[model samples]
Target: MTTSVRGDQLARLLGRWHALPGRRRSPDYAALAAAVRGLLTDGRLALGVRLPAERELAEALAISRTTVSAAYRALRETGHLTSRRGAGSWTTLPHGHRVASSGLWAPDDDLDMIDLGVAASAAPVELVHAARAAADDLPRYLGSSGYHPIGLPELRAAVADGYTARGVPTSAEQILITSGTQQALDLVLRLSVPAGAPVLVETPTYPNALAALAARRARISTHGLDIDHGWDGEMLLGALRQTRPRMAYLIPEFHNPTGHLMPAELRERLVATAHSTGTELIVDEAFVDLPLDDPAMPPPVAVFDRHSRVTSIGGMSKPYWGGLRIGWVRASAPLVQRLAAIRVGVDMASPVLEQLVAVHLLRQSADIVAARRAQLRFRRDALVEALRDQLPEWRFRIPGGGVTLWAELDGPISSALSRAAEDVGVRLAPGPRFGLDGTLERFVRLPFTLAADDLTEAVRRLASVRHDLDHAARPTWRTPTVIA
Candidate 1:
């Protein structure tokens, strides 16, 4: 019933594993154990998959048998692996692990389901009012063919004006409206990165960006973000100098999952470095307006950019409403034109009515930002307190501003716990989904976007499942079932 990973496949996986960031003084055995834990957490090493024999893996990795043996022992003691007297060791979840029926972020038909995978909430009342206003304004655009591939002139001006007000000195010509930040990213990558060209990304970055870059066949290079210290400037600069990638994707305002705001000095330095190295920096400001505590965050990276190397992507999805489907790209006029030209093969234009709604919302940015900050702060505190009270073993930093809290589990069971939580009508995203190489198995991102009561109940359910997983007898391996 155990599925054995071929020695060659394990070697290939280890090749990718070497790219994972590590501390300078950490021992090899510890790193190996952590890497294996990440693989298990990310589902690359499926539960009950028989690992290669100790000597085989040691030879594959060209490390001492003692190091491999020590790593395996560490994993066994942590409940991530189990071995029999004659049988070899097999990967496993610590007891009580159940696979989730619904895929991560997929809608569940059950009304009672608690969704913690998406860091979004219900639309604000302002959005409803704005939509109504947009309906009234729809008639003004009826005279034309309604396809504004470059976007409606008014909305583009408003977006540019918003940036100018924030000290970025943008003009309407520099902005191109898209459906959302996702589309903007796709367009940028398509237009910028050639196939197999090197593209730099932050480790534990937004998964969708990774997907977009991969779709373009980009050769991805990564720099790690420190959970406690935010980004390592020296490491980033070094990677930039060495890789000299065509593009670098960053979430500088409030990073997804981690929520660490990039310091202003670091931002300036990164812009300068990327400019010197000819790496166009794509700054995602999706969570820019959701600052829970600091209302006066530093200006966008474009503000520090003198050359036309930094491109800022903004969206209404996180701050105002995900349903709005409105976002924009801020770059040079020529670049905006280039993206719009490429966008023609896709959707010809963003919806005119939605662009109107975005304009209305941008006009009321102050009130919406204030309201969202207050609401998110309340829910964030509630979720943190509930976790502390019910599940103190889990560790997480209280994010200064952002929808989700990236918490580290005491053990490498995030994937198992995600699956089990789904069985109890709770939808959770496993940790590895955020990383490019299926690392981060010891962590999970929990959003505070849900209501306080729902957040508390979700934690309660997680606690119950953890108790079961911790106490139940070790499970026996069954025939491997391919996860659709």
Candidate 2:
């Protein structure tokens, strides 16, 4: 009933495992056990995959047979592996443990789970008042057919005036409201890029965007964005020239997960390059208003857009609330009309009530942004301090103005750690979920939107799991391999 993993295949996978930077004191046998357990927990080592024979693995890893014996014993004792004399050893989950699938949005039923995946928070108090005001104003639209695909005129004008105030000089005709940014992204890709055309994306981007593009069957080209250094301008330009993709999607302002803001000069360069290369640049600014510390962030990337090649998508999900479901696209009037026409076959139009509430919320953008920033700053600082105190081995940068911190672990075990954390009621989105080809095994995105106490408790639970992995006892080699 078990599938065996070849010695060479196991060795190849194990070669990528590196010890946590500061843990030189940990014994080699214990480290090996931890690494194997991590792979099992993360689903990389499938349940019932028989491990290589003890002597074979020892020789392949250049370690002693005794050490391999000790490591395998440790794995069996921890319930990550089971062994028998004739059947060999196989991987498995620990008793009472289960894997929880993660996504960009968490399910409403996850109230008992401590969510470290989503970077969203509760709706503001102003939202309720706005909803009430919207209800009062809803009657004005009752007399009409209520099928404004281009958006309610008042809301459209307000969105345009907002962009113009920020120096983009937009008109109501240049705006098209959608259900949310995800919808805006979908409509853009469906209308502009042909099915087989190439599209560029920044690596470690929003997963839903990747999903949307993949659904369109668009050939995806990627440019890596560094957590420490922001986007590589020359590399992006090079890719633009080489691939000549029909569209390039970027999250330049208060970038999600990484929290790296694109500089004004870099934004200008990107806009110019996209124009010259005949590529439409789609900038997602969902997190633009969620600045934590810096008050002097650059203007929207659309400010540098002269040729109308750049389209900006802004949303209320992150800044105001995820439940609002209000987002807009800013592009040329003709393009907006085309997108609106395409949207007709979709939902036709976003709900009138939500749009009315969005108008009220947009009118108070500054105050809302300022309040969210202050609260987020507190949460971010608290989470950072907790990590330093409880889990110093985990390394991460202090993000300036975003809801999440892209934390790097000591080894390629993020998925495993996430699995372990789930047993203690903590849910995480592992590093690979943010990457295109499952390359970021050593990283995890931790959102700071939860309360300070919840963040502390979540880290505590994770530290406990790490401790157990480090100190679990080695099992006897003669026990029968267990399937459950």
Candidate 3:
């Protein structure tokens, strides 16, 4: 069955579309067609999503049925939509069109191509041991249908204990396991955030989170995060109070790209602000286990959420390996059940085998985290030294703990740098990908997840690209496929 978006939902998502800044004066049908095309390009109107009937949408937008019919006809002519007499129209991407889902880290066969684009790590020996243990434990689940909409009991309890040990009170009933943090985030957005509802996020936050927000067609307000001075607590609180957003998504622990950890005082203030504003806080802690400099860890953001307004998402992707496909959400038992209910219509649940392995891995998390931190520290130092040696003009603060560095360039040529770096076999995640509407042009995310020597080589190649950029033609605008 086709997933259909209601006319009211479409109207909400397209708020002020007709009066958007810089939109040229055009006929109503033409403008409507252009807005729908923009949504497709932005990955907000997903491929295969059925559009509302022309009459229904016309009523929603207060436009004539003739105008809606013209708009639908225009979309069909441009190959953006398909229709049938009885079946409604659905969206499609033209040939060679790229969107958010195109970006994922696959093991590259080309040794010549160095992917600084993806921020992930190789699996350690512990994964192998865990898989074997899971295999031995598999028979116990063999008699069942292998469906676990919430998660396996063992993994949920282990995850709950982890939070409890980290100074947050949690129970297994509160944990909702997922395929990855991405899935957990998607599910929460579906359950909590309404279409066109205001949602607060960091200016240069995680790109995938931005993509998820787009997919949900959320109205996003942003707070800036500075590399030198972590967060502007005043600005964050102000946005919460003023916008009164339905939800706020934050990555305070080893924040992506910038890698600035939020201070305990700021987190406390943030929770209080959320409470006062009646806004739910969605805290992403995937990087919490990878502290490189041994900084005193702050309590999880959920600790201060006495009303259970905070939902914390954790996964084995960063601290362990992305290939594991195990992630979870910690919230009130009621919310967990709600997520599971919504999830049943989606994938139903993550694989039984993956959850079993996660149970074993979580049991040995302390050792796993220690090993990752040590390895990452060595690689981080190598990257820092190489950047200083090769490209002295590029400046960045070494992250306390995270897979990537948010480096500032002397000019707003990050997109150009990315294009040029590709010629020299280095793939980069340009700063614009992590920002709203092509902002953050003077920065780029450099992942230090590779081996120490490989990280050094990538920087050397980037230095060469900078030298070439000095003499090359000015670059044109292009939204490249995402990798993070």
Candidate 4:
């Protein structure tokens, strides 16, 4: 609850401030706002810590001071953060004072912010064509009431088949389609978590998940997943034993931000624990199908379960298009029915048009995944090479399956460096964006979702900032620990 000041205190508060991987330049305000909002919802930024001075931070980031000012002003208007003249800016609780909406555009016309926040790339051209073709069949469904809350039967069957093809045999009756993973998650939370009950979340889990659960007033307990070892079964078991949460949510395959896969052994153990504790396990496989290669990656945790204690969530967003928000949850038929009921009260049903489109896209799922993996691999390899060549001082864990790299920055400048990166028209997510105890302070998740040219330029700017900072701090290096 203590306010963070400048220096190390401020540095600690600025966790996960670095630019995300794959972007060649800064993203627009909306993208940047989305990233910041993620950090805020994840509790990465404490409720009230003063942000660095706008002008000073802009200089450190190497961009115009106006850009930093504008970013801060925009965030202020969103109720995510606030600023006072002499007191400085800090994150605000949602109920404190709502941020005034800053319209829908960035203050400057020329500012092209390349957001490294999301790890997804645009959907393939084939998917687009398929979508158009699917539209041609939509007229046939016009005869029905169009209030298909249970989702299109064809799409549901395809989703079920996709799971079966992946080793988890599931029927269409086990599937309840929602608009997207976001809606799917919301519906599940509604079906499971009671208001104010303890909900377990992996530390540094997806931020939007935090937003959804928190909005429902669920008490959250965070568990650790040491990126260095992937995920420690022992640590998770310890948290499970200690919290006895109503449910434990995880991203078992190609985890967000960290890009770690849950080991099979650990998955079995977790299932055992869940059975004993009566805790529901929600495994989000949004990124499971994203490895640049390796189509036959690890199986879903749901497949190893001895009981119906797991709910598997899949979406076309990450592997497809962000705008194509179609996702489904596979659980026991009874649970599926419950989720469907919950969905009706919230959104009624997934849009018929989008579901139809998903059905067509699913037909060529293998080919689409193949192309996506290849493109992502190229980008991922390029990003790794650039980082190795430019920032060798940093250590990183090369992720085998996802779009982001979990890196260990050589110095303790995670927070300061994030502010620095931001000043240079680069938006990054610092290490702590994925954790709570500040354990990921020296870590950063660099996504490989940008074009090669843009990736090169972004790395160049980041390297320059590190060089300048190192050069400026050289004279002070020789002084004694307390001599200055």
TM-score of each: 0.80, 0.78, 0.80, 0.77
Candidate 2 C-alpha lDDT tens digits along 217-271:
9999899888688788899889998999999999987777788888888888888
Clashing pairs in 2: 73-475
Query: Candidate 4, after superposition: displacement of residue 340 in Å?
Result: 1.4
Relative to the true structure, candidate 4 reaches a TM of 0.77
For candidate 1, lDDT tens digit of each residue in 1-484?
Answer: 6579866677665554433343124567766776676566444566678899988988888889999889889888877788897899987665645455432222546689888877887888888888899999999999999999989999999999989987899899999999999999999998999999999999888877887897899999899887788799999989999999999999987798899899888899999999899999999999887889875688788888888999999888998888888889999999999999999989999999999999888889899889989999999999999999999999988999989888888776665577667667787777777777656768888989999999999999999887675443222222121110
Which residue pairs come into collision in candidate 3? none
Please give the clash total of every predicted structure, in order.
1, 1, 0, 21
Q: Encode model 3's per-residue lDDT on 82-114: one tens digit a residue.
A: 899998898865553433455432434668988
Worst 10 residues of 1 by lDDT: 475-484
Candidate 1 residues lying further than 4 Å off, grouped into runs, are: 1-7, 10-105, 471-484
Model 2 regions lying over 4 Å from their true place: 1-111, 470-484
What CA RMSD would candidate 4 show?
A: 10.0
> In angstroms, how far off is 288's CA in candidate 1?
0.6
Candidate 2 global TM-score:
0.78
Q: Which residue pairs come into collision in candidate 1?
A: 100-419
Error of 2 at 359 (Å): 1.1
* Cα lDDT, all candidates: 0.82, 0.80, 0.85, 0.72
Per lDDT, the best of the predicted structures is 3
Candidate 3 worst ten-residue window by lDDT = 473-482
Q: Which ranges of candidate 4 are over 4 A from the true structure?
A: 1-112, 293-296, 437-439, 469-484
Candidate 3 residue-wise lDDT at 147: 92
